[model samples]
Target: MWRLRDKYAIAGVGYTAFSARSSVTVRDLALEACGGAMADAGLMPADIDGVVSFHFNDSVPAMAVATGLGLPGARYAIDYQAGGNAANLIVQTAAMAIEAGLATNILCYRAMNGRSGFRLGGGRELAAHGVTQYTAPYGWISYPQAMAMWCRRHMIEYGTTSEQLGAVAVTCRRNAALNDRAMQRQPITLDDHQASRMIVEPFHLLDICLETDGACAVLVTSAERARDLARTPVYIMGAAYGGGPNQGDDLFDAMRWPDHSHNYARYIADDLWASAGIGPDDVDVAEIYDCFTYSVIMQLEGLGFCAPGEGGAFVQAGRIDRDGALPVNTHGGLLSEAYIHGLNHVVEAVEQLRGQAGARQVDGAEIALTTAGAMTCGGAMVLRN
Candidate 1:
C-alpha cells in the first residue's frame, strides 16, 4: 500500500441549481461552477493552476475553463472520456497531480444541459463499432436497453425483485425530499415506483435517474494546504480504481458479463477498505451512484455491505434510509436529484463529513464512502472529516 491516506483534501464544493432546462451554454455552466468552487476556497481565479472534466466532448474542456476563468495557465489540464466511471477518476487524477507537485489547486467540474440540449441515451455514436454494426440495428443503441438486460439477469440469478429495486428509489426520493437542492423533492412510495411507467423491463420511470441541467465542481489541494482553507478539509482517505472483468471487444461478448450479476466494484472493495484503513462497518454514510435502482442494489452488494444475493433483502429492510444502517444517497443521488455525472455524490460526501448537510445530515458522520459509475470503468473513494 502506498498510503495515500490524507495526502489530498477537498477544500471547496459548489454547483448550479438543478433544473430540467437551462438557456446557458455548457461553457457558461462550467465557469459558473468553477467560480463558485474557487470562491468557496477563498481564492481568486488566477490562483487555480489545474482543471479537470469529463464528457463526450459535450462540456467545456480543462484549457477552456482555465482561459475563461483568466487563469494564466494550467499545469495540469485533462478532459477524460466516458461518463459515470470518469467521476472519481477526475478527482483521483487531480490528487495525483498535486502529489507530484505539478499543481497547487485543481478544479474538477462537470456541466451540461442533459435534458434540453442533448440526451445521452438518444445516440449511438459512443458504442463500439461492434455494437453499432450489430446491435444498433436491433434496437440495442441506448444505455437503458443494455442495462435492462443486465438487471433482468441479476434478478434471475439472485432472485431480486422489482419491488426490492423500488425500495432504492423510494429511499432516494425520501432523501431528496429533505434536500432543497434536489430536483425531485416530492416523496415517492414503493407503490408509486411500481405503478410508474416502465422504461424498460425490470425498470420503471422511478427506477431510472432524472435528466436535468446542472453543473458541479470541487477543488482539490494538498491536505497540508487545505488545512488553512475556508471549510473543514474533507481528507481523501483512500481512492481506488477498477473496471469490469472485461469489456468485450464487441457488444455480443460484453453482454455475457452480467451472467454472474457482478459489477467492477467487486474487484476493488478490498483495496478500497484496506487503503482507507477501515472496513464497511466503519462507514457512517454512503453516496452511491444511482443511475438506476438496480445499480444501487447491486453496488451495495459489490461494496460489501451485504452478501452477493442479499442486496434485495438488505435494502428492503430499510437500511439505506437516513436512520437506517447505511443511509445511502443522503442528497437524493441521480435517481431523484439532477444527474451531474456523480459529481454531486462527491459534494454530498464532503458536506456529510463536514457536518454541513443540514436536514439530511447523517449523525456522527466521521467517515463517508462515495462511488462513481458501475458496469464499466468505475472508482470509489473513502473520505474522512
Candidate 2:
C-alpha cells in the first residue's frame, strides 16, 4: 500500500482569541483564522487552492470561507458534517488531496460560537432521530449524559475513582495556567475538582470541557514545499480514521454496543503507530482529546499508553502532567483551553513539533501525537519536525 508518511506537512497554524462571547459572526472568525494561517505560511490568499472545515451544523461552508479569503476559484472545497472526531481526519483529507494532485495549498479549519450560540450541551431542542429518539425521551439529551454512562461503566469495571478523574482536570488547569490564550487559567486542586457541582453523576462541572467562541486553522501542503515556508515544517508522519465494531451504527446507542469501558483509540492505535513507524514511547508529547476528564483516561488506555484497566491509575500517578514521561495537552486542552472542537489540539501538536511552544514546551520535543474523540468514532495523527 502507498504511504502518506512524511509526504505532507503542516506548514502553519493560527487561532483567534477564545472567549465566551464574540462580537463577530462565525464566518468572520473563520476568515481571521484562515488569513492568519496563510500569513504564517508566507502565502497569499490567491495561493490557496483548497479549503476544508468541519462543524455540527453550527458554522459556515468551505466555499464561504474560500470566497471570504479571496481564493481564486478554489479547486477543492468541502465541509464535513462532523464534530471533534474529524479534527485529525480533516488534515489527513487535505494532505491526501494534495498528494492526489487536486490542490496545492489547503486550509483546514474549525470555527464556532460553542458558548455564545449552538451549545453542544443542548442549548436548543434537537429533532428526534437515530438512537436519540430512543434515548432522548429518557433525559439523555446532551453529550455529557451520554458520555457519563461510559465513564460510569469504566468506574464499575475497573474500580476507577472520581479522584482519579479529578487528576486529569487538575492537570489540564495547571497547564492552562501557562497558556495565555486558554480560557480557564486558574489552577485548581483535586479538592476543588471534587467540590465542584456535578454536571452529570460521573462528571463534575470542571470535568467537562469549556465551550468558547473561537476559530483555529492550519495550512497543509507537500513537505517539499513546506520546507521553504516561513516556519518549521511539521511533517505528517501518519494518520488513521475510523472506529471499532458497530461504529457505523448510531454511536449513542450504547445499548447495542459491545464495550462501554473502551473506545475507538484501541482499534486505531496499531494502524496509527504502524503507519508512523513508532510506538507510544516514541512520542515526545501528546494532545489527547479531553472533552471530559474520563475521556482522557479512556484514550490513554486505548492508545497504548498503559494497559487496559490502568488508565485511572496512570493519570493518578501524574504520567500526563507537563513534566511526566509523556507530556500531554500542553496547550491546556479542551477542558481548560477553548474548545474549537478538537482542531486546537492539532494546532498545539504542530507548535510542539516546531519547538514553538514557549514555557510549556517539552524539552527537545521531536515527535508529537494527537487524538480526537474518545467514546465514539475517532481519529489520530502523528507529527514530526
Candidate 3:
C-alpha cells in the first residue's frame, strides 16, 4: 500500500519569540518564522516553491508570506480557515505536495497575535450558525465553556478528579520552566491549581492554555533532500488528519455524538500507529496538544497510550513527566508554552527527535508523536530521527 512513511522529512523548524504581545504585525511574524526555517534548512527563499498555513482570520495568508519572502515563484499556495487542528494537517499537506512533485520544498507556518488581538478564549461573539445558534444564546460562546462540558462528562463517567487534572498542569509547568521560549515558566503545585479561580465547572485558570503572540514555521522536503540539509532529517513516519462524521462543518457536533469523554484521537490512533509501523510503546517523547489540562488526559486515552477512561490515572502516575516512561509536552505545550496554535508543538517534537531540546530533552529520544486539537477535528504525526 502507498504510504507517506519515511518519504518526506521536516528539514528545518523555526519560531519567533513567543510573547503576550508582539510589536509587529502578524505578517511580519510569518515572514520572520519562514525566513528562519529556510535559513535553518540552509535553503534560500528562491528554493521554496510551496507555502501553506492555516488560521481563523487571525493570521496572514500563505500568499502574503510567500510574497514577503520574495519567493522566485510559488507553485502552490493555500491558507485554510482553521485553528489548532490544522497544525499537522498543514505539514501532511506539504508532504503530500512534495511527494506529488508539485513542490520541492514546502514552507508551512502559523502566525497570530492571539493575545494582543483576537483572543480565542475571550468573549468575542461567535456567528450564530449551526451549533452556536442553539448554545451561544445560553452563554456557551467560548471554547472553555464548551470543552468544560466534555471534562465534566469524563469526570462523571470515569471518576476523573480535579487533582488528576492538576497533575497535568503542574507537570507541563515544570517542563515549561526549562523552556526559555515558554510564556508561563514558573512551576505550580496541585494546591495552586485547586486554589486558582475556576473558569467553568471543572476547569481552573491554570488548566487552560496560554494566549500568546507569536509564529512558528517548518520546512518539508523529500527525505533524500533532507539528509543533505543543514539540520538532521526528522522523517515523517506517519500522519493522519480528520474526525468523526459531521465534525468538519461544526465542531460542537461532538456534543450530540455518542462519546462525550473521547476526542478525535480515538478514531485516528489506529491509522496513525499503522502508518508509522509502531505502537505507543515506541514513542520516546510526546507533544500532545494541551489546550486544557483535560485535553492531555483525553488525548492520552484516545491515542491508545492507555485504555479508555484511564487517562486521568495515566497522567497522575507521573508517566508523562520528563523522566517518566513517556515524557509529554516537554516544551511546556500550549498550557505553559505560548500558543502559536499547535505548530509550536510540531517544532518541539522536531527538536526532541533531533536531540536539540536542551534542558528538558528526553534521553536517547528517537521517535516522537505530536498532535493538534483534541475535542472534535484534529491531526497527528509521528516523527523519527
TM-score of every model? 0.96, 0.98, 0.98
Please list the C-alpha lDDT of all candidates, in the order they appear. Answer: 0.87, 0.90, 0.90
Error of 2 at 110 (Å): 0.2
Off by over 4 Å in 1: 125-128, 249-253, 256-260
Across residues 1-385, which tens digit of lDDT does each residue of candidate 2 receive?
A: 2289999999989899999999799999999999999999999988999999998889999999999998987999998998788999899999989999999999999999888987878733567776667777777878888899999999999999999999999999999998889999999999999999988898899889999999999999999999999999999998898777776445456575679999889888888989999899999999999999999999989989999899999999988888999888999999998899899999999888888888878889999999998776889999999
Report lDDT (Cα) of residue 155, candidate 3.
94
Give one digit per residue, the lDDT tens place, for model 3 in 234-311.
Answer: 999998877765563565546566677888898788889999999999999999999889989999998999998999
Candidate 1 vs candidate 3, lDDT winner: 3
* Candidate 2 residue-wise lDDT at 302: 90
Residue 121 CA displacement from its true place in model 1, Å:
1.4
Say which prediction, candidate 1 or candidate 2, comes out ahead on lDDT: 2
lDDT of 1 by residue, 274-295 (tens): 9998889999999998889888
User: Which run of 10 residues does model 1 get worst, by summed lDDT?
Assistant: 250-259
